[model samples]
Target chain A: MPALILFWILAIVCIGAALTMVTAANPVRSALSLVVCFLALAVYYVTLSAQFIGAVQVVVYAGAVMVLFLFVIMLLNLGAPVTSSTKGSNQNTAAVALGAILLLVLFISGIFFEIPGKAVSPATAQAQGTVKAVGLTLYNPHLPWLFPFEATSLLLLVAVVGAIVMTRRQV
Target chain B: MLTGLVAYWDNLRDGIYRLFIFPEYWHGIRLPALVPYVALAGIFAFTLGILPMLIWIERVVIGLMQDRTGPNRLGPRGLLQPPADVLKLFFKEDIQPGSIDVRLYYLAPFISMLVALSAGAVIPLQTVTFRNVHGGLYTVPVTPGNVNIGLLFMLAASSLGVYGIILAGWSSNNKYSLLGGLRASAQIISYELAMGLSLLCVVLLAGSVQLDHIVNAQNTLPFGIHWLPSFLKGSIFSWYWLQSLIVPVVIYTVAMIAETNRAPFDLPEAESELVAGFHTEYTSMKFATFFAGEYVNMLMICGLNASVFWGGWLPPFNCFPFTFIPGFVWYILKVMMGIFFYTWLRATLPRLRYDALMNLGWKRMLPLALVWLFLLAGYSLVRTATAPHITPTAVVTVAHVAPGR
Candidate 1:
């Protein structure tokens, strides 16, 4: 019962903050809202018994990376309520239409799929939530997935190099 | 009927008593003792300032190590210097540069402190006993969130500390801070992967991710005998650090030093190049906040290394098995040793060039970590296939050890 209440509270906060991130006029407010969203996501991760993942989420996204985002936003003087003259109303309409379609598709899928049975509570899941479980999963039957994990890291490397190149040119 | 009423009255009395004094009633049942989370917080807060105290200590030590009086005017033999400097920094007006984000700028310090504080949660403190109303005794692990993911959480949290410096640099509206932040982010992220992998080697040997479990697993020396007896017999004892893990430890130490952004890897604030780096525009308390954050991070990283590589809260050798030196003392000593190393490096080493820092993290640490992890994992595989399966609890009990290490 308590889990239901907590999940509802966190889910509401997360959705509200995500909305605020988009709607806030000031970019700084938007960034702050994003931080709230990250925090709420972390709580949700905890509810899922992904304690390590939740901690990683906080440390990497909220603790370190978000600070960097905020720093950039602050450095850019994004606190000001800036006005934009360029407004593509047709583009906005199209985007909204696509988003609504996607939502509809998800709803249809949810109805058709009828979701799987609920998993055990986090307390019960603790038995296999250790680092060993993650390692075993990473290496054992899921060894094929290793190729993609490595490939994704390679992609991150390329992106990082690209960013450095772009920024260095400016400097 | 009277006897039944009397019993009913007794039941009602107990119910009312429990409703009013629930905690007291609950105490009647044996439960795990609570780790003093506040005590951990207090100690972490204390360590945040130890860097400056370390500065003072360094000066005193250097004076002792060499032959000179370091700072005599601030107090009797310059004892008051750090506090005075801190006071001056406090009174200096905080400057928010024009065209910078104010909220993120202010938040950088809190994020840094939070990461530092979170790292201490997994540390084991002294064990306590609790008695329930039924007079049953229960033993509880004193570490907060003594879940199996202690080391992982520490790594992730320390990784988060990088953002504070990155954001400080980027948000300052200064080129120096931006460059510093970028370099630090790149450096820290790169090295953290290696640190994670290197620690994985030890985790593989222990077959568990719990820090206490790892320490306990180390208690029995290699080949089913103690290290001393093995030494007398001219056979090496099997602590993971001594047995095929020397390379991993070295890799771990190097990556850890970089992770903490200390000395040679102190790229974020290379005054020579970046003019105080990320906090270039910060003044007064803002500057102090960044300073305090770095020191706290250093302490945390050191504590983590000690816990992971050195048997954290584990007394050296079984000289006093059941000899009760409290767990917190061992934790403190290990952390202090790490701090001492940081101080030693400060006195001895110069900052590395930015290119060198990046190259070391990628070219050296990452590759070494990868190789080391595979070796450990491979070894574990061989051992597991050949050896019989041992449940973690059975191993613990057979080893004749306490759960808290």
Candidate 2:
């Protein structure tokens, strides 16, 4: 019951921050709100007993990613109020339309889809979320996950190389 | 008399267990629920109480290094100087720069202080064992948060600390502040990689991410050599600093120094260049908050180093004299040694050139950490593969049929 209460509170905060991120005119404020949203989502992950995911979320998104975003915003001097040149761009209308469609899709899926696995007990979830359990699941030779995991890492390596190449060309 | 004193100590320990560990209900209210809050308050008091003394120690140590008498006034050799300085800061005029981001400027120092303190939550100072009602002994780590993911939590919190500096720089509307903040963010991000990698070496050796388990893993014979003298078992020799062959510890120390923006790695607040860096525009209590936050961060990181690399609360030897002292005292001593190391470096070394700092972090430390990580992984793999395995005896069992069949 206490977990349920905490979940609801975090849900509200997460959604509120997401909305603020969308509406905030200043880029820095928007980035900061996005960080708040990410943090709230991390808490939600923790409440779901996925502690590893929650920590990684904070470290990757709220910590590293958002800091870079703020750096770009500051370097570009984009914190100033939006000017009249883009006042009637109709971007907001397009965003609203796309958001409505996305919400509809989410609602339809939530109502119609039945997940394949049985709902895990809190104890099982906690056990599954441990570093050992996650590592075994990811790297076990018999499991299908190993290939995809290695592939994802390879993709990241490629991305790093690509970034280096792009920057070196400019230099 | 010694037995009576021991019994009294045991009673006090049990009382503490009741209060913090297996909290009992009182007046129909669950007491366990208050443990986190109580622990948080304790951490706050402990860190804040030590902040003044830390400042004084730093001054004295630096003065000693520079061949001068430090703080010889205001309560015995300038011992009262830190508190007086804090009081003065509290009473001084709070200055607000014109055309600054008012809300964020006010928010920055609090963010810095809060993040620094929150990182202290997962650090286990000591472990205690107590007898339960059933007369069975249970050991619990005495920490604010003993979560399985404690190390990761610390990393995450330290990463978040960049925001405070970045925001302080951007909201201050000062060029120097902006430059300082930028340097801090980049430097921290770079060093964090090496720090995390070095810590991963410990985690790899311990096979656990929890700090308590990491410390416990070190309480063994050095290199698992049974031939060593009994006193050497579970001593400093077994600690990660030596166990990991000194490389990871060295890398972690350098990375931690950079992470905290200390001297020799303090490009962010290079007063000679950026004029106090990110907090250039901050004044009075706000500046004091930043100052206090920096010290607290130093303590937190040092505490981590102690626990992760220096055998934590474990005594230096498995002997009567060393064992007589409590674990928390050793913990504090190790942490203080870390602080002294910081002051020593500050007094001994000049600040690194900006490019030199970047090169050291990216080119030197990062690669070294990565190579060491691979080496340790390979070593552990080989060790596991070569270790003797016990063979099980064969057994035969008959399948039982249903009774009717």
Candidate 3:
């Protein structure tokens, strides 16, 4: 019961922070609001018993990625409120259309799709969220996840190399 | 009459023990549920309480190094100077620069202190044994937040600490402050990679990310040489500083010094260049908050080094006299030694050039850490393959499962 209450509180914080991130005029404020949103999401992960994921979420997104975001914003001197002349452009109509499509997709999935696995008990969820459990599941040869995990890592490496190549002409 | 007196003394001892260790209830509330809260408060007090002493220790050590008397007038050997300084900070006029962002400028120092304090949650002070209803003894680590992913949590908190400096620099509306913040974010990000990698070496060897598990893994004969005498089982030699071949420890130490923004790596606040850096515009208690936060961060990082690399709470040797000392005392002593090392380095080395610092962090430490990690991982894999009968993972799982909470 307490966990449920805490989850609701975090849910409110997560949504509020996301809204603030979208609406804030200053780029630095927007990035910081996004960080708060990420943190709230990480807490929600912990409450759902995905402890490893929660830690990774904060470490990767809130810690590393958002710092880079703010670094770029500051480097480019974009902390001041941006004044764009394209405010009433067709981009707004396209954004609204995309948002409607996304909402429709989420609603349709929620109503029609049945999740594959059985609902795990709290004890099992706790067990599954441990570092050991996650490691074994990801690395076990018998499991189907190992190949996909390696492939995703390879893709990330390729992306990194591509970024370096694009940035450094001499290199 | 002597027997009656002895009985009374025994009763008094038992009453005190029960009151502290096995209290069942307190004013209609279950006491066991409150242990985490109590431990949290204790951790906070311990961190804050040590700040003044840490400041005094740093001053005295630096003074000795520089052949100065230090703060000798306030109390016996200037023991009272830190308190005086704190009082002065409290009474000083609070200043806010006219051009600064009011909200974030006010928020930065609090963020600094908050992040520093939060990182202490997962640090295990010591293990305490208690008697259960079955009259059997069980030992549990006395951490405020004994989560499984403690090492990762520390990494996250330390990573978040960069925001405080960056915000302070940006909001100060000063060129020096902005530059300081920029340097801090870049330096921290670069060093964090090496730091995480070094910690990963420990995690790989311990086969667990939990701090207590990492500490306990060190309490064994070096290289598991069972032929050694029993007295040599849990000694300083068994610690990860030796077991991991000293490379990761060296890397971690350098990275940690950089991470904490201490001297030699303290380009962010280079006195000659940046004029006090991020806190140039801060004044009074707000400035003090940033100062305390830096010291607290130093303590937290040093405590981590002590626990992860040095044998935390474990005696240098598992001998009769050494074992007689309490575990937390040993832990604190080791942590203080780490602090002394910090002071020693601060006095000895000059600040690195900006480009040189970046080169050391990225071009040097990052590649070395990666290579070391690869080598260690290969070695561990080969060992596990050869010694299939005695799998380390199996042992780790069994040990972890047996201590179910």
The per-model DockQ list reads 0.27, 0.45, 0.53
What candidate 1 gets wrong by more than 4 Å, as runs, is A1-5, A20-36, A55-86, A104-123, A126-171, B1-31, B36-52, B62-68, B75-77, B126-139, B222-240, B320-324, B382-405
Residue-by-residue lDDT tens digits, candidate 2, A1-171: 998898889888888988888778888888888998999999888888889899999999988889988887777777786765756689867978998999999999899878788887899999878666676566666668889998999999899789778868553
Candidate 1 scores a chain A TM-score of 0.79
Clash-forming residue pairs, model 3 = none
Better of 1 and 3 by TM-score: 3
Residue-level error in angstroms, candidate 2, position A157: 1.9
Candidate 3 ranges with C-alpha deviation above 4 Å? A97-101, A111-118, A169-171, B1-35, B385-405
Error of 1 at B312 (Å): 0.7
If the candidates were sorted by their lDDT against the true structure, best first, what order would they fall in? Answer: 3, 2, 1
TM-score of each: 0.77, 0.89, 0.90
Chain B TM-score by candidate, in order shown = 0.79, 0.87, 0.89
Q: On residues B258-315, what C-alpha lDDT tens digit does candidate 1 reach at each position?
A: 8877887888888898898888888898887777777777777877677667766556
Considering every candidate listed, which one attains the maximal TM-score?
A: 3
- Chain B TM-score of candidate number 1: 0.79
Candidate 2 at A23: error in angstroms?
1.7
Clashing pairs in 1: A64-B163, A71-B171, A74-B100, A74-B101, A75-B101, B28-B132, B28-B133, B29-B132, B29-B133, B222-B238
In the range A105-145, model 1's lDDT, one tens digit per residue, is 99898878755799676667864454554555444432576
**Candidate 3 residues B147-247, lDDT tens each?**
99999999998999999999999999898999899999999999999999999988887888998889988888886766886657769998999988899
Candidate 2 CAPRI-style tier: acceptable
lDDT of each: 0.69, 0.84, 0.87
